[model samples]
Target: MASERDYFHLSGPLHLTHVKWDNLYHRKSVAASLVQGVYVQEKDRQEQRKGPNALAFPWWAFFHFQLLHTLVDDVDNSIFGAIYEFKPPPSKCNDTLHKTPRYVIAFRGTIKKPDSISRDIELDLQFIRNGLHQTSRSNIAIEAVRNMVASVGGSNLWLAGHSLGSCMTLLAGKDMAKNGILIESFLFNPPYASAPIERIRSKKLKHRLRIASSVVKAGLAIAMKDKKSSSFDSLSAWIPCLFVNPSDYICSEYVGYFEHRRKMEEIGAGSIEKVATQNSVISLMMSAFGKESEPLHLIPSATLAVNFTPSRNFKEAHGIHQWWKPDLCLQSKLYKY
Candidate 1:
């Protein structure tokens, strides 16, 4: 069993490119003026030659986000995400290479704009309540991935998102799976909609409520299981890679657990589980009471957990740039190549 920590081990050229893609958010010059939706620096090419792996910038992901920026006059309104195509480039170590590309869809964390923040909140609610087609933005992402895949048949897909975007990525995976398209997800600091702890007055009261809620969750899970079983076999095909910071309040209770578990079980497959060490007891108690745990922090067992030590500055810890720090992403084996 590969622990979440094992997934981030950076070694080959492909992993190095991922680190660069993570940092692409900071290079506004590059992100804004993309050559066919992606920019490749000289350094990026140099890193490719250092190892036997070959990779390409996903113009599909970058161009779509760039389109979002154009549609909305405010930069803050941008829903940030980009797709990176990972593969082995032509090299002596890898002479015969298949052209099939593994598409990685990455979403940005929270930004400073008020509208963007509000947009995230809106999308979160829709995701929790109505599922995938609830928001136009999510629809756009799904359609984009679908079209890209259709254009290039037999392409393996991956999803990555941070903060609110994590929610989007997870939902996209669900929808993609429903369409019989399998995808792998990499989520960061995703928040879940949990029952308000303040609502529970005492442990005794909480215990009673837990029993009642268990019935409801079980019923709902069963209903969801039945509903999804007809459509898809196993969510295990959609491998979930989760990253989290223990101290971050935004991800105290990961919500992606129940839904994913049901999906995976539909096909008699198992892999989903929590990866974050922080909020374990809290999440357990919440689950006992049938409340949703943290969002992406604590999900299905199959979830590859990559835990991070948060910064003292709470805001910095949750910021997208903070997670991309070399000390964090570069420490672990990022790709299996």
Candidate 2:
């Protein structure tokens, strides 16, 4: 079974091109102009050969708190400015964890803009599935991969994304599974998933005053369960492996603001509108001018954890947000493949 440490521990660049399979892949590529929605391919190699495994972390994941810069169809906004591309390591990574090469692709596109709802249905499954929508990132992502895989062909593919990306990742998985496409694994963290199940106690990761008994019960379940039974079972031991954070206040307050704003139709109450405005500035500027990427560094914090505050400006907040927690000791967990 794969451990949380396995994924949470990886610190470095990951390519987003992993989601597409080889037979469906045709071009050698990496890197996208965040300012420009266009992606630039790596020099095509004569012999199209990929390493035993690959992981693609797009610009959005690599350049967090950055910008969103992409324009397509009728969708236009400043929510997608800081996207960047990842380069896979050369030479095959031959090892045990490399159990069938895995490729992860993250989409940095945004569907929910403060101004537009044109693509809302396609962006938010809820708009069509449950509520109005989750985010436009998912729809944009699915289309991107369909186009990408149609152009590249090398090997099997595995898709992974967080937040809004989770739905996109699931979409890819379901489609591939149904079509019998090659897929390795999916690495998702605190998906921005929208469903009736998400609102239940079973889905909430928050700690509470009344849940002490529940937490104790959860811990006991972990102790009694056989760790080797199944992946989900072994992992459930850490149920509510809660991250009571000092920084939680900001998130908590922010959630309230949005909930209020949404209910009252008052977008001006919280600093969210201000922040979103600033973010839009960044996105617009970035879309017009691409930026350079610094070395990737993983920062661990509850802001990156599940159900963080400030639902806008960012998609998924967990994953590599805080890659160095003690319980989240990733040193031994990463590099399985």
Candidate 3:
């Protein structure tokens, strides 16, 4: 099992930028400049830790081959997504240690707009069992990632996203893995495929809907297992790590489902198992139905439940302040894990 410190360290690199969907296009120039600054700072920061026994950051995985590309929807030429590729460095420990460039693809969270990525998230939630519609923004993100990978000779990949982007990260990872690409995905406060039923306003309706949702979720889980596709859920190397605030309704609370816990454990993500349990209504239903279940996303390799110090502002903690805090403009120390 991993402690909070391990998660904090693993989370260091991703903290380079705050991820939000629509804001991604609008803040491109600023984010690029910020990444450059972080690159320089990282070099100096690593040098300070240099000693015979000191661990080093994967600079080659992040800075040396840093290439940012913008993707657009072919239909309307709307900004589809942005991806960062890190071409493998020539050598590290020894001259012969070859490496493949790792791609860091991020998706943005939902925005309250009629024509934004949030709409796609809602659609994904509506059809959690089937996943996003082909023309949904989430699916478009998958196409963008696939195209980027193909252009680079189909190298190994890494993924990170915030909020709805986090959900997109899972979908893209699965699609890429099905195509024979290995990946490591990191998600920050990822939501369940379906929206929370706590807001339904009627307990009876909520319970019935929960049962309905559970049946649909279980059926989909069984179907996926039957297909035996090379989705991320079925890949050994496709490790995923999730970071969430303890009180986050979208992720933290939802992990209670037996299916969600089973998915995490199946991937050997023992770190998250501590916080997850088998008591959720969905898990109970799956057992009663005699169907094995799995989560909407791959079980993470590790789950970091962060409880920010000093202040526990719900919205603030739920955001990716662990990386970059836009409201405070504060950046934490970067670590190489």
Candidate 4:
């Protein structure tokens, strides 16, 4: 039988052990690895019945972090997220290179397996309906994050997740930001519920459609001024790091989401763009039906990082494994509200 280490493709003797603590790439790699660890933990649980000592920590050794807690889905009893406490070597304890977070809460995305697929897909659908926060899994994750923040404070705590898990992180981070607790967060391939306008082939047609959509959304915002409010404005300063691939339609819209805002500014429609970006059409429709929903994709600020490197397929493009790779062609820009 293959060992758990064989399952981890990125972490081993050849992994990023030499990278300093303050290296941005290293931090990204560590966050991705920790999230992957949650996947391995779940796999261990599934296989534990086969033999003794089946549980494993595949990525822990490479990053010098210990699993402090695992956030399990109450319905399926499967692991979804984990809290890792950094355990640097004694030799490097006094070095200023220890600027990294003392604790990190990383969430894993959907795992397509018989043991966890149902719950994962259910949460994915809830994500589409903007009802993910109402699930018990979300409640558990938010409580875990909140307790961690209260235990150690937010200054040295970090939140990270990929895909559906990224949605959880965004919601949790937003909740914390709303209460004046700003924690560093990294979101990879987070799904945007809006249409995939970025997939359109014609640049001119795409631009025109975006402009029309923005105008309509802006008009609706003005017409519903009394009913709607900019609750996200307070989160303007808490910018999470968003990692996206242009080839991945689930997340690629974010590339245009931020870019379109800039174009709106260039055309002197900054005020319209502000209102339109804060409120999505789905949220407006829900309000019409007397249903309150918060669009999980909308955010006031983010440090958007787009991968320019061409991917082989959607799976390769959307995989969390790519974020930990050292030689990635990426373009990063900070969009501030």
lDDT of 1 by residue, 19-99 (tens): 223332222112222221211221223234223232223333322222221112132345355555554323312322232
Q: How do the residues 30-64 of candidate 4 rate in per-residue lDDT, one tens digit apiece?
A: 78878777777787777663344443475765667
**Model 2 Cα lDDT, one tens digit per residue, 258-323:** 232242234342232222211212222323344321100101111222233332232223333332
Model 3 misplacement above 4 A: 1-67, 73-80, 86-102, 113-121, 127-130, 153-156, 194-233, 254-295, 298-311, 324-337
Give the range of the ten consecutive residues with the poorest summed lDDT in model 1.
34-43
Worst 10 residues of 3 by lDDT: 328-337
Worst 10 residues of 2 by lDDT: 293-302
Of the two candidates 1 and 2, the one with more favorable lDDT, higher being better, is: 1
Candidate 3 lDDT over residue span 181-216, tens digit each: 756565677775445554346757755654555455
TM-score winner, 2 or 3 = 3
On lDDT, the leading prediction is: 4
Steric clashes per prediction? 25, 39, 2, 0
Better of 1 and 4 by TM-score: 4
